[model samples]
Target: MKQARPLPQYLVQRFQGWRATTFGENRSWYRRLAEGGQHPRAMVIACCDSRVHVTSIFGADTGEFFIHRNIANLVPPYMPDGQQHGTSAAVEYAVNALKVAHLVVVGHTNCGGVAGCHAMCSGHAPELEEKTSFVGRWMDILRPGYERVKDLPAENQIGELERQAVLISLENLMTFPFVRANVEAGNLSLHGVVHDIAEGTLKEFDPVSEGFSLVG
Candidate 1:
């Protein structure tokens, strides 16, 4: 019989600290949340990068934002093929069940996933070209975006591709009928954001300007 291992000491200590301090002071609020359930007004689809602190950036408390994180914050086109689609499922639940009023797709600078896609597309990473490479296969969703920036100089291409991730995800989100209907009815709004990791700066996409403006 196999035995289960204990959690890492660092994580255990951190959880204990939170339980004793943060949770202790907010016990009543936690209890209320447990009973009342979450009714967050926004759904944030952001990259699964440790540096991208979604709640911290927005100053959101627990249960305020329904967030889903994935590589490069990419959203594939809607495909009702009855396959397992984690991102799509999350989006569906957030839109239909949670009835979130806003949907935000966030991208970031120096993203590893975007870098990987760039490498693979530039014929620099032959290993990712193999059919068995999951990252490469998943990154196929960003090929269209990659094509748009492939012509730029190598140094400038990555940043443009990173921004493209947000644009592509926003464009793909509209492909969902529910998302489209809600957006058209003014029930939900879609936004694209990009975070500059090193500079601690944020930029919001403006459809009118067709560009990203730094958020003050």
Candidate 2:
């Protein structure tokens, strides 16, 4: 019979440290969150990159935001064909059930997923083009974004592609009927942003100007 392995020593130590410090100090807060359930004010759809710390960036307390992390932070156009859709399910729950007022799609610089999509589009990453490659299929969601940036010089494409991913996701988010209903009703707001990981800065997208403005 197969068996599962225990967590590594470092992770165990880290968990113990958190329990003794962060959790210890906020025991009541944690209990209240557990009891009251999560009623977050916003929903953040961000990249799965480890450096993208959603809660820390916003200085959010526990249960303050419903976060969904995915490769390249891409959300496919709504297709209710009944196949498994992790990202769609998260958005649906956050919008319909949680009724979050704000939905933020965050992209970032030097994203590996964006790089992979670029490579595949340029025919440099053939392995990613295989039909059976899950990452390839997921990255396909960014093809429209790729088409917009493919002609840019090599050094510039990645950065622009990353931003494109955010815009693409924001556009895709509207395809969901529930999200659209809430947005049209003025009950939900959709925002797009790109983070420069090294500089610790954010560029917010403006629908009127169709450009990204650096946030002070």
Candidate 3:
């Protein structure tokens, strides 16, 4: 309880500035959103990378997306073992409660989580291999992705692995019974996209083509 602390001064000032400008100008919109509750059109599973601005990338406003951020933007295979599953819970709510039509998994370049998975798989990061490491356990969800790209040149693994993370998550999303039902009924769609940080471009996976294509 003692660990709680006040927000930094810069953030406080930034919030005040936003309240004065954005909030002041859009007060009615904010009020309507609060009253109506969130009915986002999509659910975005994305990396917790600070540089990945999911909202700005899609030109979406508040209440437009139900976003869940985690390391590597991974979705673990569905396990209804009565354990605490934050990502799964969010997926359930977005799929069942919110009834979102589109579910997008967003991955990005130079992801620290993907790199850690590579290091751990290659026995280079013993720290991440330990059972006590929360990050290690979480990154374990992407091991299948690492295994798929392990044989490629070391230089090529990172980028490919990043995309694999997105694909793997999309695959895992179907493991959820509710998600599977919705997809089967044509009520929901799954998508995977990788944002190239250096190039500022997006690549979307096409299941029919079995590859990713440039997105505008």
Candidate with maximal TM-score: 3
lDDT of 3 at 4: 100
Q: What is the C-alpha RMSD of each candidate to the true structure, in Å?
A: 1.2, 1.1, 0.8
Candidate 2: clashing residue pairs, number:
0
- TM-score, cand. 2: 0.96
- Point out where model 3 deviates above 4 Å: none
TM-score of each: 0.97, 0.96, 0.98
- In candidate 3, what are the lDDT values of residues 16-83, reduced to their tens digit? 99999999999999999999999999999999999999999999999999999999999999999999
Residue-pair clashes per candidate, as listed?
Answer: 0, 0, 0
Best-to-worst ranking by TM-score: 3, 1, 2
What is candidate 1's CA lDDT for residue 53?
A: 98
Question: Which number leads on lDDT?
Answer: 3
Q: Kindly report which residue stretches of model 1 are placed more than 4 angstroms away from their true locations once superposed.
A: 1-4
Question: Which one wins by TM-score: 2 or 3?
Answer: 3
lDDT of 1 by residue, 1-216 (tens): 468888999999999999999999999999999999999999999999999999999999989999999999999999999899999999999999999999999899999999999999989998888999988988889989999999999789999999999999999999999999999999999999999989989999998999999999
- Model 2 misplaced stretches (Cα beyond 4 Å): none
lDDT of 2 by residue, 125-194 (tens): 9999999999999999999998998888978888899999999999999999999999999999999999
* Cα-based RMSD of candidate 2: 1.1
lDDT for residue 58 in candidate 1, whole number 0-100: 91
Instruction: Pick the winner on TM-score between candidates 1 and 3.
Output: 3
